[model samples]
Target: MPFAHAVMHEENGVFGISFPDFPGCTTGADSEEEAIRKADEVLTFHVAGMLEDGEVLPVRRSLKELLSDPEAKEGLAKGVLFLARYELPRKSVRINISMDETLIEAIDRAAEHANQSRSGFLADAARQRIRDLLKAE
Candidate 1:
């Protein structure tokens, strides 16, 4: 999970949002609630673009550290603080794996029934197993 501190405020009746750690990343809405929701969508897209560009995502900073920045200090002076959390997945990669022929055939049949490729089916299964194991821990 990665998070960015956000500041929400209104000027001329339009709500504005800002992410201190992400200087140029900003968005707004007509209401505070919509502003918060839009922030999540915007941040997710921003982070995805950063990833595509081979740039590291901005690290979250403490409120104190954020305030130390002149722009953040000025931008958030009259704003309410909130956090935007994101769980982003990396780009998929193909990998070689060994499985029993019988199991592979079964998997292929299951994948066809589910209307998914064998690789896609296996990836979905692996992801679900990971989630289940983590929950059991």
Candidate 2:
């Protein structure tokens, strides 16, 4: 996983978020909290798309590095900064684990309801939990 600096600007009650390192990658929300949350999703998907297309991911810039750029300076003047987590998807590997039968049954039901394989459902749930934990910090 990598972290990118996300710039957040607000206009007309809507908060807009963008990543300087990843051009054309952006998202927005109705509040600051929502903007932060959406930034994570947008950054992750944007990087994932880039990877899928065989595009090279840029090396993330430090806050100092970003502040040195004139364009970044101007954007910062109008907004604020935060780090958005970027987890690159990798090749899947098979694994085996033991769990309570009832828990496994419930997971299967939830996966079916969501139209996702059990592996996908578990992966998404884990990612969301990681994001929530990171936000709490």
Candidate 3:
């Protein structure tokens, strides 16, 4: 299944890569080929963590619909195409938690390394922990 999203643009001498659906997910390279190569690595970890959590994947919007929206022009320019076959809807829930500063900092570092925002990282961590708990039961 398709497991990642990427958008690219040429600015100055470098190609900037960004993942639209994934906040804080970004990587850049000197060329299109190099950027795509790096994107593969970034996507692997992002999808792996999701798989571990049994989390559903993101849906791919239709090209027609996307194109109709002016906002989507930028994504189209960057070659952002969603493969419909890989689309999977996700379920969301709200929760509250309290943790130590050290732990929070660690999570933040982990999130940065994974190219995800703090919220995404915490959600992934929580999901994985819950999955492990269920498996152990």
Candidate 4:
């Protein structure tokens, strides 16, 4: 299990939560409680997406250090702050999808050449696409 820090900034009745360790990882809600709950799911998805994209996980700063930061401390004054924990999934489930036969063969060959399972190869491709899409925004 790994842990991450989250800071919630309240604005106009909305709670916007963000992770200092992960610059782009964030979620929000109307209440502090909902913001915390959303942070858990966002953290889980973010860590898994990073892993899938073959990106390095960031080393988390201690709570004391996070609290010491100017921006984080500013967030403290503006609203609330907290920590969220996430664990990688212990098991994987098989899935099915329909595709063109030619594409399927190409994907299978690429997976074999990459020394990866078909699922793993496809997962990596999807994650990379997501990264590209986000970066273009």
Candidate 5:
């Protein structure tokens, strides 16, 4: 995966990280390095979840491009701004799940066979688990 652009700054005595491509995704830490680490984790999870469910990742704008946008400026002024490459596939759904690792592994393998990433496979597994639970209840 490519390194997503991370905007780092200090706020309220802590470091803040934001991705311009993904709105509503932000994190803070006590230091710049920590902030970047948190940003990397957050981006990975966000991208993985999005890919699992097949959701479109919004294209991110470069810092220079963002600075030219009035809306972007307003967001930055409000202490929120960031961007990343479209990291995952796009889809939409809602589900509940409670499954063990064995089941999860099975789904993962199936997804791999289908050429889908683990996230995508686990998403389907979650859906199935939910359906089974509902049927049982």
Candidate 6:
């Protein structure tokens, strides 16, 4: 997991988020909670697109370092700062595992309903679980 610094500002009751390290990557919502959630999603997809396009990801900068930059400083002055977690795309590898027969059937049914392969469904479930656990911390 990698975290990006996000600045959230509210205007006319709508919340907007921006990543200084990733210029042009922005998202918004009607509430703070939604803004935070959207920030993570936006950053994750933005980074993935960059990786697909052979663009080098920017270095993660600390709050102190960001403050030294005028643009980031200005954004920080008008908004709240938080870390948005993003996952880097990786090459797929096959693995062998065993699980209860009933559980496997249930997973297959759900995956079919969601129109996703078993691996994709399982990966998404695992990621959501990890995010929930992190939020609990």
All candidates: CA RMSD (Å)? 10.7, 7.1, 12.1, 4.7, 10.4, 7.5
Model 5 segments more than 4 A misplaced = 75-137
lDDT of candidate model 2 versus the reference: 0.84
lDDT of 5 by residue, 1-137 (tens): 56565667786788777776666766677876666656766676667666556788666567788788786665577664443333343465656777798987887779889998776666666656754543333
lDDT of every model, 2 decimals: 0.80, 0.84, 0.63, 0.80, 0.65, 0.87
TM-score on alpha carbons, each prediction: 0.63, 0.65, 0.47, 0.64, 0.52, 0.66
- Model 1 earns a TM-score of 0.63
lDDT tens digits by residue: candidate 6, 1-137: 99999999999998989999999988888889988987887788778768856999999898889999999999999999899999898888899999999999999999999999999888778766764553343
For model 6, the stretches where C-alpha displacement exceeds 4 angstroms are 93-137
TM-score of structure candidate 5: 0.52
Off by over 4 Å in 3: 1-5, 52-54, 68-71, 78-137
The lDDT of model 5 is 0.65
Looking at model 5, report the run of 10 residues with the lowest lDDT sum: 81-90
Task: Mark the 10 consecutive residues where model 4 has the least summed lDDT.
Answer: 128-137
Instruction: Report the lDDT tens digits of candidate 1 across residue range 1-137.
Output: 77899999899999888888877777888878778877876776667657745998877888898889888888778898899876686778888889999999999999999999998788778756754543333
Best by TM-score: 6
Provide the global lDDT of candidate 6 against the true structure: 0.87
Report how far off residue 113 is in candidate 6 (Å): 32
Residue-level lDDT of model 2, residues 8-111, one tens digit each, is 99999988998888888888778899888878877887787687569999998877888899988888889888888977888888889899999999999999
Better of 3 and 4 by lDDT: 4
Mind giving the per-residue lDDT tens digits that candidate 4 earns over 78-125? 666677887775577778899999999999999999999899899879
